[model samples]
Target: MDQKIIKVITGQRRVGKSYLLFQLIRLIQEREPAANIIYINKEDLEFSFIKTAEDLNKYVLANKVEGTKTYVFIDEIQDIENFGTALRSLLLKEDLDLYCTGSNANLLSGDIAGHLSGRYVEIEVYSLAYPEFLAFHKLAENNKSLDKYLKYGGLPYLIHLELEDEVVFEYLKNIYSSIVYRDIINRYSVRNTTFLEQLVLFLAAHTGSIFSAKKISDFLKSQRVNMAPNQVQTYIQHLVNAFLIHKVARYDLVGKRLFEIGEKYYFENLGIRNGLWGYRLEDRGKIMENVVYNHLLFKGYKVQVGILGNKEVDFIAEKDGEKLYVQVALTINNPDTLEREFGNLKNIPDNYPKKVVTMETFSGNTVEGIEAQDLRSFLLA
Candidate 1:
């Protein structure tokens, strides 16, 4: 808050970016009772006239308080053309504390970088984490609560709706459409809308599976939807850019390098994935993996799929120069299941923490030095 740098809050649409801005504003108001706040929401028709950079500058300047510092908050700033230019000019004034929210990941890339490099900071927002889900729904931690979380996922607005398939999925499908049609298809001027939706369905069904673009292309060809690997890769990139899904690269644990070919994709919001593809009992394993990946990200870890020899580790999470190995499974009740999950981590050379997260609660269970954690406890941690 003391810095002059602009706080750029970025996230997927409906992931609570505006809510975050409102929270910040509330905090500022509590701290500074006389704070001069200039708020502009592009989503609201009231700000429709402020389309260009000059118009934005004029409005902020016109609304400026005489002597006090102005705390300016712009919602959906990406909606305005040449908004970086206005932000750059407004940033010059020592009296303005600028903050803005954007739904696109590229908000700070390309032209925006040229205008506000080193003059801003980015804070990414995501759908609610598991702990947040429990708190938001006011549900106690148990099988039922966890099941609801796994099925519905955590979009903050979901709190308003009854947690039922018909009602929640209806809302989630609409959000999926907005993200797909408005964010990716419209922004990228996508030509093959049919293939795009099909690709999303493919991703939803095969959530944690690792495959190359060529592999996906080949599979699509078999389905009679022919798209070249390059084009398929481009469309996938569009989905990633839109923050609809996260693309996790595969890392070779032995060679200590990232693999170029295969990668795994997980949804940014699981509810959206479940909404697009029905949440079924058979997909429990994939759902568990996706849930683990999202939780790792929520904990601010840089996560990647790990490959060591023939064994595959679910996640190799790194943060602040430290690493953590994680494996997710439906259960380790079967002896083979227990060994496979822990055995993969045992082969890892270094001494960083290794854990196995499962559906069944097993307290203080350790295999050779690896800790075993239940899904709910792992999420809370």
Candidate 2:
């Protein structure tokens, strides 16, 4: 289906959306060479002239390739204003299979669907899931190698081990800047981007932890960079829009309550976060949780950071009639640590398949009624 359809691929930055689009185009070209594939990257300086719908129509006419199934591939198309209408017009009048890639979900939300109703399909792509990451880096499926993927995530371009750590960090830094400057600042006309940058750093430093914007504002205030709670909230939304951070709301299944009090965030790739800040093994739990979050999302589950009773489940995945309770920890370690993790699953008082995944151990057994499984095995399975 990924290759058969001409669809819009939306995902976080550096998550292989562009590359995936290119791959699909190549596949289509191999099948139908006479099928014209005109690729236009909106960020290109040559396409800078495409600011309005008229410009787009002219640009399309100038570069029009002749074929029965001409594949029109556009990348980062949100840069062009009123592009939705132009695309709608082209799709309506022409016999073209359209493929577009965007950095975020704005294309789906902001008038694109309304303008091009039932005209296109959307496919979401994500950063390398655990299995993909392992395959990309040619790493053995073991605790030690999975640890490396967790520490520095699987951004396809950075899979090479020969690249210096500093070089990788610099690349991530450039990506961070692109999201901040191009996606947020340029797209939203946000003033005083310093607060936004600080907010992202704060969120990245404390991923997987649930806290309110007011609490974050208070924390920022203590650092002498006092900003309003509303401002902090806006900054967080901006980051989420740019796809650098994902805010997961706490779902209280027992109480049947959806509270806006505390929300958790996960980075698109742990490598970028670890690169920006000094890496630490102590932060492995959040890194693993981030990996799992991306995995469940790519697997087509509606996932949430679960708040059940007094314990927090790392992920609550639901699809169709199935529900999964997940707990992510660095290791099953000693009895006490094991109890803490397994206890969270043990107390659920429901049979929804509880799992405790970690970097250690290959044994799969029932610990205190909670199924304990190694992270690598889960991915491979």
Candidate 3:
């Protein structure tokens, strides 16, 4: 908390970065009522005149109170031209503490980092977690809440709207379009937007499935889109850089190796995924696995897909030397499904905690030394 370096909070748009900055401002106000603080939001029309670094510096200097320590908070710093220069100039003042938020990866692009001389700490923010979602909606943790969470996801605005399906869908659609246009297309100057849109839909539909760029290209070719594998790979990288989707690599549990090919991609928010597919429930199991992957990330675990011999464990979550093996399923009612989920965890040699998470209502059971837990209970825990 006492670090003097500039703090950069970054994430996808509308993921609560601005709100978090406001919360920090409130905290500072409560702690030090006399503290001098300067808040500027680039999205506001009042700051439209402050486009260049000199303009920004002049504005801050003109507003800042002398003979006092000042904290500066700028939202969407990337909107200002040569923002790094302004930040660097401000860093020279010993009394100024600087923090900023940006929505896209361009905030940390090569030239910007070079300009800043690596004098900043980055804090990446994500959407709300399942437990946070429950708290936001004032709902008890249960199957119904979990179902709603899985379908709509943890985007904060959805909670604010009370999860009305139509309104949430429209909001998510707009957010998706803004990300695609501003972050991906405009930033990368992508020409074939149709192909990019198709790639997004393809990835959204096949979330949690293993496929390479060549495979995706072949699938698109079969659909008559005809994109080269190299091009597909580049587009996918853009999506990842924009923080719209995440790539999860496969880990060989037996050999302790990381595989480069055939990794799975998960959307940053399930609500956006549903918005892409019109809220279809065609692949419930895969969606369940994706949700579990995201939930593990929210818990601050470094997660990977585990491959042991020929079997695959859904997640290998580790944090601070503690390890957990998890398998996610829509249900374990069928004997084969139960074995498939639990048997894979049993193959691990060590005595690390193993769990199988499912949508089953009843809990408190074990299969082959692996705990079988309902998804709601697992998420809440």
TM-score of each: 0.96, 0.91, 0.92
**Model 1 Cα lDDT, one tens digit per residue, 1-381:** 857999999889999999889999999999998899999999899999999989999999999997889999999898788899999999999999999998777787754677888989989898999999999999998889999999999999999999999999999999999988888888789999999999999999999999899999999999999999999999999899788999999999999999999999999988899999999999999999999999999999999999999899999999999999999989888999988988899999999999999888887648988998989899998
Model 1 CA deviation exceeding 4 Å by range: none
Candidate rank order under lDDT: 1, 3, 2
Q: What is the C-alpha lDDT of each candidate?
A: 0.92, 0.78, 0.86
Instruction: Kindly list the per-residue Cα lDDT of model 2 for residues 191-279, writing each as its tens digit.
Output: 97888877877877798888899999999889998898888888888788777878888988788778878899988777888877657
Of the two candidates 1 and 3, the one with more favorable TM-score, higher being better, is 1
What 10-residue stretch in candidate 2 is worst by lDDT?
A: 1-10
Q: List the candidates ranked by TM-score, beginning with the highest.
A: 1, 3, 2
> How far in Å is the alpha carbon of 126 misplaced in model 2?
1.5
193-251 per-residue lDDT for model 3 (tens digits): 99999999998888899999999999989989998999999999889878899888899
> Model 3, 229: alpha-carbon shift in Å?
1.8
Off by over 4 Å in 2: 1-6, 61-67, 160-163, 362-364
